[model samples]
Target: MKTRNPLPIVRLAVAIAAAIGSCLPLARCAAEPAVRPPNVLVFLVDDLGYMDIGANNPDCFYETPHIDAFADSAMRFTDGYAANPVCSPTRYSLMTGRYPSRVDATNFFSGKRAGKFRPAPLNDKMPLEEMTLAEMLKTKGYATCFAGKWHLGPDEEYYPQNQGFDVNYGGWTRGGPYTGKRYFSPFENPQLQPDSPPGDHLPDRLARDTAQFIDSHRDQPFLACLSFYSVHTPLMGRPDLVEKYEAKASRIVGEEFAREEQVLGDKPRRVRILQKHAVYAAMVEAMDEAVGKVLQQLDDSGVRDNTIVVFTSDNGGLSTSEGSPTSNLPLRGGKGWVYEGGIREPWIIRYPGITQAGAVESTPICSVDLLPTVAASVGYELQHDVDGVDIGPLLHGESLADRDLFWHYPHYSNQGGIPSGAIRHGDFKLIERYEDGRVHLYNLSDDIGEQNDLASEQPEKVDQLRDRLHAWYQRVDAKFLQAKPDGPEPWRP
Candidate 1:
């Protein structure tokens, strides 16, 4: 008999050993699980009004097809509001999941414009000790990135990187894109490099950077915050787009586009009775286009199904002043007042498999609720105190327990708003002017414009709301404007 080859026996033995190693329960494998955590994208727009989007206002002069389409597939919060009626404080609430009053960030930072009452000692920078939404998400292994306006603090240490973001594109202290060359290339922003081609728009550049981040982190969970500085001040748009809107405006009937004046506080504020501003309309369309680009990138990457998208604004539109670009018609004050128009925002959220598509929730929600909602969506538990309640159930078509929403603005607004505090419980709202102790009460369900003041008629209701508001102020240790030792003159910047 021929001798069996020992080499063949050795090869078979090695193959068997390798198979066993591969099948071992404790051994690591080359292939990972197909499932991954959902990515989060927050599209934050600055100075966008409640009625600007077609989804919210069918009569809007500006076209926002992309936003309206997104709303069709998302849950729209009809009564959504910013934490404060300004940029920095509302942004603080978004990042911390707490009322801005709790941290003494009650107004736009560095707002030196004084009024009859001295603006409550302003906290110019967001406190570093407070845990931000990004920091909490990072603990759960989410790659955090921020691109856009970050007016939370005044220094570099208070920027996005220091606030828990792994990467920051153009976040800085300035609320608007007033740096570099305004909204074009060669930006003077210290955090962002001027790498785009000449004459490149800031919003488009921001969207591109954000899309690149999403592309690079497709395989992992990420939080991409795209905050647009468009439609704010220094209203500028592409020449072609401005012409397009101007032509559209010219076609409208004379009665359709008219200007009106309303006496707010002690001054006559000119309100844009209609949305006919050509430059403003162009800015809005450009912003919508940028949003479309980002959403398209998400779809092209094949990760749209596994992403959670949120669209909102820092505050109401600029109507009373600063070009008086847009109208918040039925909502009362804009930007810095305590009226419905000032704090109300467009809140749209899309979470695949969780939120019901094309649903509407009229329950009032605030920016403070964003953090807790995002944390719960990812199955993470928060360990610290939060003023916002988790509205996850609301997304699934379940009702949340009724609660109150509050706002405190002790400084005068550039848009001609007085120092005021407000509280909303159910359909009734109360506003307290700080200069004097005068209170105004309105039944929002009956008078959404806040034109009818029922405080004098309903004394008991006013007393009840005033007491509760004061009690809350004590609970949060809210700061207030102090009386000037000497009779103070009307404050001007």
Candidate 2:
């Protein structure tokens, strides 16, 4: 008789307790909160091309098995692009999430004297006015580290530490660590010691540093930027891979042809290029292996599921105009031009909850998008003005409204030819040559080669893009001719 028909009262008591629990202060809550935040690992390759990865083009000169494996677990961005045509500028854009031109750094520098147009001092690095991604992430209670190339600035005022990186293992100067004697060397080089080296290879050395960073901070949220200087000029590779490439080069560039050209006192056009490509391929392979090592470290650390990994290059592959002219074939021109080959680079993002594995995001995204994208991903609030919009929606399979992408490469490059600006609106692209102020228009949807110049036929379209480009240039206060107007021509558009 004591417990008879008491079910209704028991239910009422349970409801009252639930209501009280919901009303209690969060601090007094019964369940302990999960304080974990995702880790971010960015593997930035130097001067990589559009078709470098197996996923982009399997028949590419450099076969990247490890990269393909990583791509298997990532989302491949087909239309990814660099913020600038060259290295230093794109790097600056990647770190700050702003266009390089806006900062008066439109070209690559190695702590050298600046040219007339770009009068900014190279001795000083990226302006302290700009906030770095690392600085912002550190505010969110994440441990930040930068391994490898840090070209934004060289002086103490511009060092990685000053930029908010807690620890920076191997990055100084404008270029990279020089291995052997060469035609040219960077101003400051931090040589790696052999016996206590991170790995036998330079790429592996950088990878090892990244692994250490991850291992030390796996329990907590971390931001590790691993920049590998592989496959750049002065192509160097492991002795074994070098030998393999040497054998391959010997067949491709036939000894008889090489000797015959020498006998005639003429250079064999194909011999040097063939040798370079072989070495270049090996360098790329080494870089891919470095990426593999980092991926493995993430997996072994039990934080792979919660880590968001991004892989990309600073700019397009170095063209024939530079030291080592890696090919960016079928896309026209490399490195310094306004062509697709110069700006387009490989991009892959792997995050379990945010991006789908094996997904392809062909939505156009520039290097400038990185800052806003990462900020959103890391749950950070950005106060500074950012030119790029958050591309997290695109990564999540959401549709973005059609928008035009513009570029302004003002300074004349040492190798890849003259100054230029370009605008990509939908499938149509308008290229403006600064040398002659000539406008070339092409529908990239139909012509990825950019072989045709349809400016005459598409006059109205050309004028529209040209005006829009310059209007933006004015809006950003882009670097331009100050001393003398470069002779006005008819506005064709």
Candidate 3:
């Protein structure tokens, strides 16, 4: 037994040798701190209209001083778009870098309302096989975290922590902060603190959780996806902010409601043309404060320069439904339509040292492009095929090929938007309505409001764009409207 104890002595000698080796000026231990890897932060707001922020529309009703200042320091996209007109489909695209239509995940999860026809066989959950942004970042030795709004799946298996995140705070099955007083204290969200005071707000709390994650993971690379549930529905705001906006809104004078051209449904819906919703305005400002707090944390952690920040929305604002809270005035159609207002989002990217301050890019970008862009930015090579191209070139003050952008949403939007597919090629865009196969064409450069229809005038362009859109449907295996029990068969692509 005493002779066999030599193994312990050998272990002690090895430990001493390793400790001395670490202190030695070896390349792995001593080369300028080895330059900690870059970090990624994706800030997503829910149902936020493009013009709702002061950066896009300064004369607008709501105030977003923090967002405006951030826009001044970041690169703004004039032609950014989501993958669909609704939230879930667009969210799926951002996670997988693939068109939501590929899996028939076109409608918002579990949404199957039959308008003129039954919605296509719905795929309600994001497939677990898909490599999410968090999973990919993890391969690069980065800690991943997701906070707020995980509406991708119907159960826990599809939640962020299961998908790839090491930390998940306030992300669960429900889309909105629908716990306790809804957005106030005692959230009752199992993933978040449940015993908060009545006055505590959801957005601010989510931001604090995210800031703490950054501080804890500051020693290593990390990806913090702070997706907010603010300004979505069941509108509520800080009482002080509500009062502030109420006073500010009183000074403005204009009609609040305007008749939107009847796009679908039996009756015409009134869209809020004025941005004077006091509660919504307050929510916007509070969300801005949350954004500002996270940005400040980046500086406090001494990781600001090493981070790539992105800001966008899941879909367009709630101008046509759920109270018609805000207006998408110049942009036709809100949350559910296949028009500019439903899909054109306010996208911004800030790459500290690499990007110019207050720079603007006119190139068209989609939600799917996010995965590949972040991959390239972090020097990670993607092994899976994706529908989105890397817009990293555009971010570097270079150019991207004039490629086409596409969207597919086959469900009746709770808002006034119809089931349709749209394609944007150069300045010409075409919308294909599913009920009767009728197409509406507009030159977006000439008609940002999408008022003038050129389908009859530009038949050849229509044919060209329509052909391209059909080809995409085939490529993505897109699904469309289904016939009802006694109803006419819906049009097929």
Candidate 4:
């Protein structure tokens, strides 16, 4: 019950967790009173890249064969994460399981540039007294919808149907698909209408309007969410997938850019460690053919065994900057550099008959742990304290007690990221650098390409993760970077 004011008791805990309709372990629904709860869906791909999928880079050059056959029926997550590295603070910590730096919302919604200081005061939006995980699954009966890029508010009262979404395609307040011919179609997104045709393809017209909103809400519990302003940036594709990735980027070959050590301005930023981008691999195979056209409309509405789904990405992959397109090789710094290739993502999840299919699980989890792990696999509780957990027992293989994952941006990252903050804990991570507090640590099970810094060989694990990342920046009241009135005063804890 420790919410910073949980929207005045969040519709009375969403009418008593929907009048106590319990049992939902992904809709197996225990005793099955004629079963019903699952149908969630989720997708969410912009800027994609935890090695752009082939089940996390089987030499990924960007053809995610239907997200690697839905990551072989989903569990996958070799350390997923994205509670911010870009895109509207990891879509406001995946619609508020909390931690978009509590509320400064860290960065990317009306981004406010500034470097040596000046970015901490940028609220931008996502507030409407905050209850959203599609307004607590619309009082638990679900039927939500929402299609693409909702850059978490700045107008229209806070789009995505005022933050609960009963239906809102192309969620607005700008963040790309910047209208008409932007990704194709006459998509002049005023909540994305013009319903395709006129050169269709805005990720197959938002995956055929989210597979006709999961075949008109398959028979009840829908959530939908689709969110894919394709591989991001105006990097248009689909001229036959840019001529099949320009003949597979003309038979690939080595050395694509290098010089990275400059964390934001003073120049030195190259870093596209080579994923031959032909219009971002034709916008990552037309957003994996719109996620295999919404997983073939959840197997033609047989509800794909009740439907839980949940893929990832909201940040990472725009290798170094706008035209850098895609390459997060060995994962260092990409999208905006809170690095592990800017918040390593592409996690899967599935949940059909309780998860385990291709079950992978390295256990890092984030994106504010997808609203308390799909609102506790659908029974939907979330009464308060959310920094993220309940990985639904790591999708059934089980085990989840250790914790510690943090990030804050404090601005300056139109890519070429600089103001930073990070922490990882278990395999050690650290980071810091908000102008010059200067720290780096690594270890990520032996440097997951953070290029081995270990902050001067682990000075007591960088003062125990910089004192638990400055006590989680005073427990999420974390805004930072400020001087510049005539400048000369960064680094504040």
lDDT of 4 by residue, 124-230 (tens): 78898888788888787888988888888878888889878888887888888876778877777787765676887888888888899889888889888888888
lDDT of each: 0.88, 0.74, 0.89, 0.83
The runs of at least 3 residues in candidate 1 whose Cα sits more than 4 Å from the true structure, single-residue gaps closed, are 1-35, 254-265, 488-493
lDDT digits (tens) for residues 296-403 of candidate 2: 998899999999888999877765444544666666666765688788989998887878888998888888888888899888889988877788887788987788
lDDT of 1 by residue, 1-493 (tens): 8988899889999998788887896765567664577789999999999999999999899999999999999999999999998999999999999999887888888786765556787888889998998998898888999998999999898999999999999999998988767887777788887566779998899999999999999888999999998878889988889999999999776433233323234646676667888999999999999999999999988889999999999999988889888889888878887888899999999999988889999999999999999988888898898889899998999999999999988887888776888999999999987776678999999899999999999999999998889988888888777656686533221
Candidate 3, superposed: residue stretches over 4 Å from native:
1-33, 263-265
- What digit string (tens of lDDT, one per residue) describes model 3 on residues 193-311? 55577778999999999999999999899999999998788799999999999999889998888777554556787888888999999999999999999999999999999999999
Worst 10-residue lDDT window for candidate 1 reads: 255-264
Show pairs that collide, candidate 1: 180-188
Global CA lDDT of candidate 3, please?
0.89
Candidate 1 Cα lDDT to native: 0.88
Candidate ranking (TM-score, best to worst): 3, 1, 2, 4
TM-scores for every predicted model: 0.90, 0.85, 0.93, 0.33
Candidate 4 weakest lDDT stretch, 10 residues: 21-30
Ten-residue region with minimum lDDT total, candidate 3: 25-34
